[model samples]
Target: MRHIILFFIWLGIGQISYAQEVRYETVENISYVDETASAYAKEQCKLDIHYPTSGENNPVVIWFHGGGLTGGKKEIPDFLKEKGLVVVGVGYRFSPNVKVEDIIHDAAKATSFVMKNARKYRGDVDNIFISGHSAGGYLALMITLNKTYLEAEGLDADELAGIIPFSAQTITHFTARKEQGIDEKQPTIDELAPLFWVRKDAPPIILFTGDRELELLGRYEENAYLKRMLSIVGHEKHKLVEFQGYDHGMVYPGLPILVKEINRLVKEKE
Candidate 1:
């Protein structure tokens, strides 16, 4: 009887281990744009996908990297890997070489591609979340808030699971202003600004930023104003988080919070 009880315990341990095991795969450099797109568009509009192969209907997180809209490559954050989620790292054209509007269109195209091809990678189209740091965060907010961008791609921005931008610009991106010969210190809010598109009916969003005093010029203040405006517009599902000691480069600490929020949102959907 002792030997039999020991065998049963070993069997239970094996079953538990098997239940906890998950396999993941990474696919790199797939173009999101169509064949008719320009050469530069095809080159810059690629994305890398990292997804779990063992799970069905897993959530997807599309991440954009920060480079102030001038430079940055697609990269899957190591913290997001192997967590029973599909992560897409997007690449888009830079400013000056391409108009900022065109860069935003690239983000929409990538999102539409992911939404359309999600099931092929075992991802849940309904659980597709968008996020990024700084300039990438700005792109995430622009495409999510401004319906025209996603609408042009045959998608409704409201269909997204959520938006979680880290230290994103709430006003017109400085790069867009730079293209117009405006200095970075000057603040502007227009069609290119995320603050210009706030609505009560949009998807849930959680804006994360560093300390107000330690952040880049007006970064925290802009996000705070965006939160206030969202509340004034009667948007119920928006939130803002400030990390005390971190500055503009707060992606590392903010990523875990992003993962938590993603999980919370996913559970809410279930």
Candidate 2:
């Protein structure tokens, strides 16, 4: 009887802690400009976050918007917000304002910031998941496959819990190659390409793309190539999912499945 009473007391305390957890939203203005004149202006490069309430020790997802790296906004995906997870939506200077490399670095900065400060918001730093759509997906792959960027922040790519890229580019993104006057028909695996960085021991990766026939601009093919490369490298925890009727926009059609996958992955590790 005494032990039962103690158990209830302990349960009650835990409940209070969970109930006391709070949600938060904030922005981080990160800069990348080198010139003094442009530096302060670069500070406008900001990231918005929508966090859970009280207990910040849950999973975190650093999400990016899709605009081919040339156009996009910093907004969290609708389906992701209500899934009982912390979502950090990042905004970086676009291609014309800054180079693609700079944007990639900004994504890293935002992700690293989320990871480092997750505990304060009841987020589990160890369980950080990086995901994005289209251009955002490209960023996710870059951060996961290339250790150089995240390494600079003292965070290893392997440190990420999971990576789910929604129809990212498998080859060098056309916009990036365009800067070099590289034609679309060029088959070179340039350094700017994500395909140039596949490894065997990357964190768990789940690639999702629309049906091959319905996807935009061969996006599905790019995802397929990425999956193949990951496989060729002996990636153990990588998976490829095809959204049957979904299109390029991952807003509603792909939301439920994506959330389901995250929940499944989280539950599996538990």
Name the best candidate (by TM-score): 1
Q: What stretches of model 2 exceed 4 Å from their correct place? A: 1-44, 185-187
Q: Report clash pairs, candidate 1.
A: none
Per-candidate TM-score against the hidden true structure: 0.94, 0.84
Q: Candidate 1, which segments miss by more than 4 Å at Cα? A: 1-16
What is the lDDT of every predicted structure here?
0.94, 0.78
Q: What is the lDDT of residue 170 in candidate 2?
A: 72
CA lDDT for candidate 1: 0.94
Q: Tens digits of per-residue lDDT for model 2 on 14-65?
A: 9998666654555444333335535523554566667666554678888888
TM accuracy, model 2 = 0.84
Model 1 RMSD vs true structure: 2.2
For every model in order, what is the number of clashing pairs?
Answer: 0, 12
